[model samples]
Target: MEEVIVTVLSEVRCHLGEGPAYDVASDTAWWFDILERRLFEARLGKGEAQVHPLPVMASALAYVDDARQLIVAEDGLHVRRVADGHLALHVPIEADNAASRSNDARVHPSGTLWTSTMGRKAQTGAGAIYALHGGVLSRLFGNITIPNAICFSPDGGTGYFSDTHENVLHSVPLDPATGLPVGAPSALYRHHGEGGLDGAVTDAEGLIWCARWGAGCVDAYTPAGERVRTVRVPAKQTSCPVFVGADFGRMLVTSAYEDMDEAARAADPQHGRTFLLDLSARGRPEPRIKLGAI
Candidate 1:
């Protein structure tokens, strides 16, 4: 198989952009700047990106009941109504010490919204993961130091969650009916470094395409947790990646320089920008189902 092509779609300036999701219906890509606390949407070939200021640190996002809006993970959960720009606060996230906040999130096939939190200063095992069910948020797992990428299998029977702090990946058995993991999470794989392995996207074949933060590459892995391929990037700290556009063929990635040194930042101006990758795989993703008040 030929290697995937990674190209700079937008450059190294997003004020710490993290979460990225593609909207096939609108023919645009969406992502958030966590530190900047803003949500953004940009159509391919479009001149400018539309930015919406959000309350608190917005981590990751996905489609909600409405196609025009999304369920956003910030310091809390928020629903951004696309038509009026009205943001409805849904959950109040607890701060460990006014220094901790949420991180990566994923919307499952069964419509459950899952996300995790991280310590403000990259502290170890202080973060946790949670799920938003029927608008009510509940803690599902913990001991996470740097929770990042999250996604479910095509069958919704499994979920992939990564902790960047320890560079450990976990696979939890998912119960689709209640939308929770069934047993103690098991290790999928562990990297040697303390970082890399951030945001992720699942291909149609159930393989994972992960943003190898600090590795300057997007890594693809088989279901058995084996490395398959890598999309080398110019930026070192790749924040996240997701399949975009109709048929989920277009892959989009986000990178950050927030944790880089002065010399590194000076050397790379595109560190915080986003990139587009052309994958051999083609197909749009299934949108999260909207659950009514339970």
Candidate 2:
């Protein structure tokens, strides 16, 4: 049970902040306020974050290249130009299902993008997980309430996801070449305490760092599902975590005040604020997503 101190990275509060990502080439960090339909960007160690209002609700993103980004949104996968922030539809996800929106996502070492979709109102069994690679999409899991913790191992041979509603994390063997699962997912860990599993990321040592919603902490576990460390966050609803900085020695965590009442919001004053943590763990650089002819 190790603890680390965190400082506010962005002061702008969000109703539902998630999907923090970092682009090493530009030395910038990006995240989303999902409910607000807004995207935020900040240079590592910069003073403040710049806000961009989006036309749709987007939860996650992957750097396609220096000039483009792949955004996982409510409607579909959008290709966003870096120069002017122009966005064009690359592909539709659950576009016909207006009740569903994108959730947590992460990129595999093989240049595959793994994303999830969830019901707008958190409807039971109204979500699923998908993997997109070379412009093709494949549904890996379905009948999920809240698909999250979408991450992969350093070797890309293991994929991890969690249904927050069930408070259980699952792991599946993946085909590293295609980023597709080769076997059924098995339960890796179940939380019986305060918070549920939200989002997670794997480090260079193959350790999983997961945010615990409503618990105000991030927990680290070995690949064997043994909890090893915990990092306390000021915000209760910690949603996601991403490695940032030039050396990827720092972690950026996003929080939310989505379902908080007035009293709860007041009690958790730091809710919805993104934080930067200095820790000993090192992170692997996020791989650029491979895009085929669209």
Q: Whole-model lDDT, candidate 2? A: 0.92
Residue-wise C-alpha lDDT for candidate 2, range 28-61, written one tens digit per residue: 9999999999999998755656999999999999
Tell me the TM-score of each prediction against the true structure: 0.91, 0.98
Clashing pairs in 2: none
Candidate 1 lDDT at 138 equals 86
Worst 10-residue lDDT window for candidate 1 reads 65-74
The sequence of per-residue lDDT tens digits that candidate 1 reaches over residues 93-143 is 774357678788888887888878778887888888888777677898887
Cα lDDT computed for each candidate against the true fold: 0.76, 0.92
Query: Residue 183 in candidate 2 has what lDDT?
Result: 97
In TM-score terms, candidate 2 sits at 0.98
lDDT of model 2 at residue 239?
Answer: 95
